[model samples]
Target: MKSKKFILESRVKDRVGFQIERILENEKPHLSQGSNFLATIGLVEPFIGLYIKYSC
Candidate 1:
């Protein structure tokens, strides 16, 4: 995950880890999808893009 993907404070980068740790410690929010979409998209999209770029 890129730092400041959610927050863009001037000095937020220094606290990114602490921010996530706080969320995990307090909010405990879950990141998920209905299927394997999130997991496979990272692999599949890049493959498709490479195939298109090199094949055509």
Candidate 2:
């Protein structure tokens, strides 16, 4: 079986991972530079399955 870290690393190298990172990076500046709620929501939004599924 593949190790968990290896699996995670591989996933990060693939299309979905790259797209996700791209989305967040693009959106990051709009939220706010130094606010708690903005930061919280920004990170939380990506985990919804629909977002990931539709985003790519």
Candidate 3:
């Protein structure tokens, strides 16, 4: 079960990183402030998830 959870989290972090990289590369020039904020959120979300998961 722990291995499964770790795998899932790893996959999610990879996906998030990929999506943020895509957004920064493709849409950064035209992105508004709100979009930049969302991108920041994307980058931080995985850490937040891990914190919450282990804080219990």
Candidate 4:
């Protein structure tokens, strides 16, 4: 499996909302202010472990 790390922008800070924004910003096209929040954020290992009891 591949490492699922954020492709962080040089300009953006590494934090909750900004991390989510970076994910969306790297989409095939581009980002606007009104992009869907749910789609942008993703689940990575630490969060998955905190949320679920079983291995994925």
Candidate 5:
């Protein structure tokens, strides 16, 4: 079995990957830094699921 630290690190990487994907996917012309910041913080609703699902 994997160690707790390893699993936690893996989940953190996955969460970051998920967030990056979300940011890139939703980015478009005329979008502001505030919008991207919101996406990064998971405040836009859809992006929060990854954190919820992968959280320890």
Candidate 6:
């Protein structure tokens, strides 16, 4: 049971990491150092929101 729970959690983590990586790759060209800070927040905000909504 514990192993099953760990597997599910790891899968979710991997999926989220993949999505963030894709977002970063697509946005990299258009972002500069100054705007890069906000871009990080923008990139993660929706995922956090969705995770909260679904995890509940």
Which numbered prediction scores highest in TM-score against the true structure?
6
Largest lDDT belongs to which candidate?
A: 6
lDDT per residue, candidate 3, 1-56, as tens digits? 99999999999999999999997888767767488799999999999999999999
Give the distance in Å from residue 3's predicted Cα in candidate 2 to where it truly belongs: 16
- Identify the superior model by TM-score, candidate 1 or candidate 3: 3
Stretches of candidate 4 above 4 Å error? Answer: 1-14, 28-56
Each prediction's whole-model lDDT (CA): 0.71, 0.83, 0.92, 0.57, 0.80, 0.94
Ranking by TM-score: 6, 3, 5, 1, 2, 4
Which residue window of length 10 is worst by lDDT in model 4? Answer: 1-10
Residue-level lDDT of model 6, residues 1-56, one tens digit each, is: 99999999999999999999999999887776568788899999999999999999
Candidate 2, poorest ten consecutive residues by summed lDDT: 30-39
Off by over 4 Å in 3: 31-56
Candidate ranking under lDDT, highest first, comes to: 6, 3, 2, 5, 1, 4
> After best superposition, candidate 3 residue 15: deviation in angstroms?
0.3
Better of 5 and 6 by lDDT: 6
What is candidate 4's lDDT per residue for 1-56, written digit by digit as tens?
12333345423455767879878778736544435563455435557767686654
Q: By lDDT, is 2 or 4 better?
A: 2
In terms of lDDT, model 3 sits at 0.92
Residue 32 Cα positional deviation in candidate 3, in Å, after optimal superposition: 12
Instruction: Please give the lDDT score for candidate 5.
Output: 0.80
Global fold similarity of model 1 (TM-score): 0.37
User: Candidate 5 on 26-51: residue-level lDDT in tens?
Assistant: 88544675777777667556657767
Higher-TM-score candidate among 3 and 6?
6
Query: lDDT tens digits, residues 1-56, model 2?
Result: 56998898787789787899899999899766668887888888878867789899
The TM-score measured for candidate 2 stands at: 0.36
Q: C-alpha displacement of 32 in model 1, angstroms?
A: 2.6
- Each prediction's RMSD to truth: 13.2, 17.3, 18.8, 18.5, 18.9, 17.7
> If both were scored by lDDT, which would come out higher, candidate 1 or candidate 2?
2
